[model samples]
Target: MSEAEASHRAIARWTSRVIPAILAGVAGYGTYVVVDRICIKFLYQERNQPAAIIVILILYFLFLLLSLWSYIKTIWTINTDTGLVPLTRTPPSRASSKKQSRRKKEGDIESQPYAASAAPDSDPNSPGLERFYTKEVFICESDGRPKWCPDCCNWKPDRAHHSSELGRCVLKMDHYCPWVGGMVSETSFKFFCQFTFWCALYCAVALATSAYSLAEIIHEGRPMDGHIIAAVAISAFFGLFTFSMTLTSWRYIFLNVTNIDMLKKAWVYQLAIQVPRGTPSTDKYTTITYPLPEFSSPQSPAAGVNGHATGPTSPVPAQENVSSARDQMATKTFAVVRTEHEENPWDLGWRRNWEEVMGTNIMDWLFPIRKSPCARHDVVESEYAMGTLVNTIKERYGLDKLPREGSGGIEMRDVPRESRRSHRSQRS
Candidate 1:
């Protein structure tokens, strides 16, 4: 097996093996606690004590089974159901493959980047046009070179390098968390949620059963209240942490973007069908729309078009196919729609505007404790306003070219209103 595959097996094996052992340890502890409390403290050992002991034993066994079921289900979800795959599983686009072949002939590096081309000549009315959506994806530079997989023979997507350890491209991957016995994602989020709930549940059940025993112990002059309190406190803390993570993850899912996309400030673009301006087409006949700015400023995050979202107003049909390259190439035109990953207007260095919208003390509320000097007011304000410093981004968004009150700013040059109207009309 390849190193990557071997790593994956190791991960799977450790997870499958180590996790069960931990669960067994927890079960053993629970048994010791239950037996000590019931047999030594709670059971009276009088003539009628044996009957009460039998009833308690039956209930304890039932509770243990329920706890085991929840634990097993959580482990099962973590080990499977997450849509991870090896780089070998990722298929390369034909264009990427051709590029690699040509490069190899010239004795260049053998690997190809993970991206597909935009079909500039495409039919807007064709059903097969959505493949262009995948074409926009680009590997983020922050992620290092992906391990070369014999199956893929190309570079993998961003945040998706081969884990010689896991042998799969983990979805919503952070790191391979061994404690839970596998990779992390929505599935693991749910698993953690259930695990926390089960832990709290067991804690409550244990405490309640032990309460009467503890009362007797106190009557007999032993203080065990501290142990019960400690267990309860730990349960509360774990529950809160697990619940908060679930909500944050849900926000990322709704945005249709990943955490990496937010930090890097990048946009995905694809070539699409071209059409004549001022033509109306239903989404069925309408191909995926793409945006092209006249000029995009490298320095500004806010200086790009805010592309609109797309979806069918009507129900879509399955098994639809179109291959009329001639008709597709002729009638369609490209337009832009911003991905959900686009930086918000507030993210640009528009501090006054941000303070106005989010309120004067927004930073304090958003980031409490103020632990890092880098996260100070001036730094936050500057990074947020960086895009507004550029004139191109401001003009594209139809904002004022220069700040009305600033002294160190550019002067506005006048153009004929008629020429401005013509330019605006052309854009439409």
Candidate 2:
């Protein structure tokens, strides 16, 4: 590496190591001051309550251990599953290579579709095609190409984003947090949440105990101990910080969204419909932008792939004809449009989403030792955001299903009845 590049990497390594160490040192020192200096040395000793002091010390140590475990586990998970390691396709086995060579010699290889270009022939109805259609292959919508990460020299997986600081793609990345000295991602999210919770809990407990002692000192008109003052102030500040962090983390978990998801949504409109170059001209078609209704009126002209309208209909077509035409139009339109936010396929529903990331076992939910269901699988299968609510609304509107492309491209006005009810409920 060049001197400048080497210097940059050295700085990153130093910061990543030093920041977390400093945070840990501060936390450890504050805990020691509160429990040993204030709670035990002053409060418990003054009251001659040796048993209470011992119990408090034991609990303090237990919580401190748990916090350390969570922090370490979060860091470990991020390191292992950040998608930084380039994944190249495995080479064909010798037997397969020989067979391919024979086929080539027999002049039959030319007729075979390239593996990169064709769907698997073993199963014509393979779910792979559906995955590609849904943008789960991490293909770029701008030009129908796979999104390549130059830093990693690999194709990015769905929902994985490149982190400039880390110089790699992180799967389902939330953000690079300086406080944690690492990127928060799919594998580490649960642990990160647990860390925040434990940190806040520890700080709050310390603050409560220290505040009590401080109050006693004031009531007796005695000078407060310097250690007690320091503990109370540090605990109060960190307690609020960690508590807010915990709340924010849980909010995103509940919504089945991430900070990155919100950021991507801000530019979702840039993904426009792209028509194939050879599409036939339709004089009577309508070009509708995405976020269209689940079902348009029969009189509404079919939209072209280019978001243009064709000429007016000659007459009322049969119901079946209208449905078929609409489906065809939708399919063509969807094929060309970028799938960035086409559907939050990762959102299964509030309950399922929570269960997937937080674990079904109540104990596991409360702790960070056990792996979450989502962590077991590399790829996360998702559905629409608020899927249950959306389905209920669609059924109430006599719409049998969600939009063909999952609720990403459709408009709220297309389903006004559901939108109105949602609005009223929100207002109330």
Candidate 3:
């Protein structure tokens, strides 16, 4: 490997392994300091409350155990699911090959394709489609199909991205957290969320207890202990930081979006609207651009579009838009286009989306004991699934409705009148 690659590997090892160890050591030291200085020195020895001190010590240890377990589990799950831990396999023999072929034949015989026109709204028996919605329908922009990661040497699953840090493709990767020293991925997301929650809770409790002890000392006209002051400062800082992180993580969980998704909005939009090869030129590829919500900053432009502002704007001519019949036809097809805000195809309503990641069980939603499956399992399936979120959106907006022969192309009726007025005002 090159010098740069070796350096990166060293950094990854330190971050993913050494940093976590260091954090654990720091936490242990902090616990010792708190128990010695505050709990024993102030609460028990001075106040003569041995029983209360024991109970408090027990609770602190319990929180520490939970936090440590969650952190370790999160890292392990991420590594396992992201293919960071390589599995050993023996060379396939003729017998194994024959068995695989036989299984493939049996599988093909049992499977049946759903009709393109069928949707969850129209079809009563389309639960499978809805279950596997995100994976089957979402297409990559590179070739207007599910993409193969050259580095991983495998078909990239829906929402999976190649992580340079981990040297693998991670499913639904939120981010590589330096604090945790690992990638927060689909498999580990729940545990990571729990870890943050626990961290915040533990810190808050410590801060509260330390503050109370300090306040009592001051009221009794005692000198402020340096150890107590240090404990308070550390607890306060970490408590606020962890609490803010927890809130941010929960916000993403509720939205069913990832930190990476938020950052790569333009890329996601580009992937969603990629037109398949051999699609008829007369078929208008109507891309609905949604206004960025008030919560999110409008700072990124749509793919292939040029504008100073982040809002959706007209498509600029690119090298890809050559003077081919298909390109010419696409231009003509959308000659009288009506721009509307595009909804996220992956958003299957907040409730369904949350359930998709966190599981349907309320207990499972609250706890991180059980692992939740990835959103889209059938990554190798065809372009579109019958009852998927994408299909549902298309059906609701009449996007799949055939264009009239004399009409320019697909007519979108959800165009906002306010947007048009704004356009007019800008022109004037």
Candidate 4:
């Protein structure tokens, strides 16, 4: 198999393992909950003590904490090893034949290349460049030939596309997010971490509070209205919380892809469409001779292949360099070593806040969106952004109507509502 395919397979294999583990954990927790319920009944009926509830609550919290901790550690690595943060340096090196040093100096801050490209160099009458940055894949140039692949969808932004992990094209594409929910955005990551802590605490508190109340009811042989109200209130709170959590997890699962990886996938798909089966990409696509936009010397190219120079401002020549530069090598993406400081995605201040409040006994209000997936407004805003992306794609790619040769469409208002709805449902 080609290297890229092999790497994807490896990721799939590892991710599959996580799926089973999560499933098993869920099953285990269900079993525990059931057993605890039964035990509580027995203890109250025969032993006649409130301690039973307390004991069960402790055990339940312990298990919840354990599961949450494991998930946090695993997901955190994706952000750390990948370019989720500024990535002052390159990301960590994966196992591969083409090994190279991928470090960077501290304080070399950078953002997505597209973000910078969104600003105009000098034209006053010209619209802001951001209008062109789309979330869907499609050809921008009318002269560009229709190179469609059944396996992949057309992305309008050219470079902005989707990663399989993230089910949709992301702005300033990075990589797929794999946390139980999805991409590790500044907002989402914070919620994910908070969700972990709060979930454990919530579970513990509910369990303790419930058991104590039940014990009192059993011992007193009376149903107090206040006790019953409290129970109902707790249940209501949990139901709402669970509803929100489910939404967050669903978002993660559907769009777990990143901006960087989106381009990589789109690039590979284009190459695949152009090349015949069994054909390999040239050395240019496989090896990195320079750093990426987020890590290159201000004067240097974004990256290179096999020691060849690839500048930052310009893309590798599309036609001439196709043969010698990016020969069909099969590998589509490369991971490089990056510095820790450059990798801070949470904004400098947020990371500091995380370090400070993490594991501390602070007022819960201090971290409002401390649960996974953060808040609903953030989710809604992301959707709104996606809507804009769809419109951009329609403008660039000529929407449902195929583009005429040598011309690309770029009218955002032209996209059909049904198509956008269809894509949204696909994600849902």
Candidate 5:
């Protein structure tokens, strides 16, 4: 390796080792201030109040140990050495066989589904996941080609995103988080959320006790202990931080979304339609946008390889394919404009969404006792987001006239309504 590359690696190794020690020291110091300064020092030793100290210590240690255990579990869940989080995998994580894990060991993150582009017959070791392909495998374009990630040189499935940090496509990757020390992705997301939750409670208790003690001291016209002051500042800082984190993490999880998905909400979702270059125009076709728009949409594009322009702000390039469909017929791409509310097609409603990431059992929540359900290529038919997605697909391709895509001629609106009813019934 080059000298500069070696130096960078060395520095990274050193930082990784030292950073954990620094964090552990901070956690240890906070624990000391709460248990030693507030609980034992002032309440028990100075005031001789055993019952009060006992109650406070019990509560304090409960949150503390729970938070610590959760943090460790989160770290364990994302362990780079073990391929704890997914690099790629076929089966849902909770159900991954030992042979499957051995084959795709990197994929152990949350319960969200991940369908590998690898066909079952391509690799001898392939676990049979049916190699489900989404609409992405066809119409989506980058460099005028369908392969989603030019960097990874692969056709990514729906919900899979290329993580420049990890240098590969992550299945349902949330974000890279340093606080929990890894990618808050499909595998480790639940552990990370639980960690934040327990930490929020821990910090809340720490802040309350320290602030209460400080208030008591001031009210009595007594000086504050330095350790008590330090504890209060640390507790207050982490309390607000953890509380906010817990709220945001669970919010995304409950919505069955990742931070990446949130960022791409406004990007035009386009599908390239290929037809013979001399085909007659069909631009009069109309799209019925959901919560249907206040104004009607512009006419559909004339069938061509690359010609019709989209909205002024639309990012769908007025570019042509140099490969594939361009070898014969022309291509006509359509932008399926969706309102912000309907953008996410993965939302399965709150309960299933939550269960997808965090699991459905008490022990699943209480402990890091199980893996999250791996993301499936095929979302359940009852999912609201799935309905929105299927609805958009139906509208974009003029499937309204063709009954082959779905059952009967149920209006697209009926799909989400049925899904909503399903959610309501299960919720009830």
Candidate 6:
């Protein structure tokens, strides 16, 4: 809005274009030196090694082609998951009465950005539990509310983080990479990885050939040229940079985590519990020594394994419930389940995690030839499967050990380490 701010915006837009051009110019110059100075002038004419020149040039062009294709695709890539989830069902007859009778209440159930309509007997204000874990999430607040993005005015999808640069919520959002010329979200992620990988290979080839050609000139007492020297230096730098990027990208891909998630260290299970109002004492909370059973594959969708629905859509499972209505009017609150271990629920083992991001085939891993399997099912089917830590906790305590489901009792709460230590000191 201010003059300085407007100028800054203009400068940013110009730099975005300039950076890509500079990169392209550097790569172009490297290509020229490799093809013209090294292959044609030195290898073909002076040394008269047509076969060697042919072989080197063939490899050079292949890597160059792959790098360029991936770069272009990544720049132009658009994600499919960017949009609002409009109200799917109309509000019922009591909507007017409720609107008139009830003011905006604190701790009101958070409406989901894509919450399906409530069933007839269900509280209209309460949206269904988020079943899918891959992208869409139902459990948001500790009290089982979906996360609402104030800026985006929608329920932020699972792992969807708002990018400050892009000013939008990006699903499985990664950092904004200048080399790729955009924020690497779910769509452009694969192409970005491929571009870095192919470009690394491209630089390696250029560096090797240019260094070899320079060696030949040195052996023959030929003077060095600036062009060949620049090629080697450029290739070496780019090679290191791209190689590092490739390693980081593939590592996260293999682990089934994103750069943002890794930065946040938000790999813990965001579990929930129910409690009544009026400051219920912590005494009502019970610490079960062990966790409940890992909800098996045949369980209700709401009681999904690692937030992924294991079975067909069914009504919320008949868990331990209170018979009286007074006990049922409980407020749900959030708890974080943490162990003295690092566990990523999203990790489906290294191989399966790789398949989730890059697809199954070797070609798919090496090149951006096809969209990944995760791309198709970003909505519901793809899973955020249960992990070892969760299973460990579940195995510790049987379901019978947990509190009655609707009793408004805190079933699980991970007290901070400091609190636990202080409590132990007092006891001592």
Give me the candidate number with maximum lDDT.
6
The TM-score leader among the candidates is 6
Give the per-residue lDDT of model 4 (tens digit) for 380-403: 212212223333333333332422
As a TM-score, model 2 comes out at 0.61
TM-scores of the models, in the order given: 0.41, 0.61, 0.62, 0.29, 0.63, 0.65
Query: Candidate 6, which segments miss by more than 4 Å at Cα?
Result: 1-13, 78-139, 265-269, 272-341, 378-389, 396-428
lDDT (C-alpha) at residue 316 in model 6:
46
How do these models rank on TM-score, best leading?
A: 6, 5, 3, 2, 1, 4
Could you give candidate 2's per-residue lDDT for residues 102-194 as a string of tens digits?
544564332232333221222223223233334222223332323334333344555667665665567677887767767888778898999
Q: State the local distance difference test value for candidate 4.
A: 0.35
| Residue 33 error, candidate 5, Å | 1.6
Q: Candidate 3: how many backbone clashes?
A: 4
Candidate 4: residue 120 Cα off by (Å) = 17
Reference-based lDDT, residue 376, model 1? 24
Pitting candidate 1 against candidate 3, the one with the higher lDDT is: 3
**Cα lDDT tens digits for candidate 6, 283-354:** 222221111112322223233223421111223455732223322232332222333334665667888888
What RMSD does each model have against the real structure?
A: 16.3, 15.9, 17.5, 18.8, 14.7, 14.9
Q: Which ten residues in a row have the lowest lDDT in candidate 6?
A: 284-293
Task: Report the C-alpha displacement of residue 88, candidate 6, in angstroms.
Answer: 11
How many backbone overlaps does candidate 2 show?
20
Per-residue accuracy of model 5 over 1-428 as CA lDDT, tens digit each: 22443464465546545666776887799888878888877888878988977877888889889888888887777665222223244332233323233433464321112234221222212221112211222223311122234233344544566553444566667776666665567777888888889888888888888899898888888986888888889988988998998899888887777787676535333333222222232453222111111133322222112333232122233353123222212122223222234355565678888888788887887677676764323343221225246465556555444423222122446646766898999999
Q: Score candidate 6 by lDDT.
A: 0.57
Give the least accurate 10-residue stretch of model 1, judged by summed lDDT. 297-306
Candidate 3 ranges beyond 4 A from true positions: 50-55, 83-136, 148-150, 265-281, 286-342, 375-399, 402-428
Indicate the worst ten consecutive residues by lDDT in candidate 2: 297-306
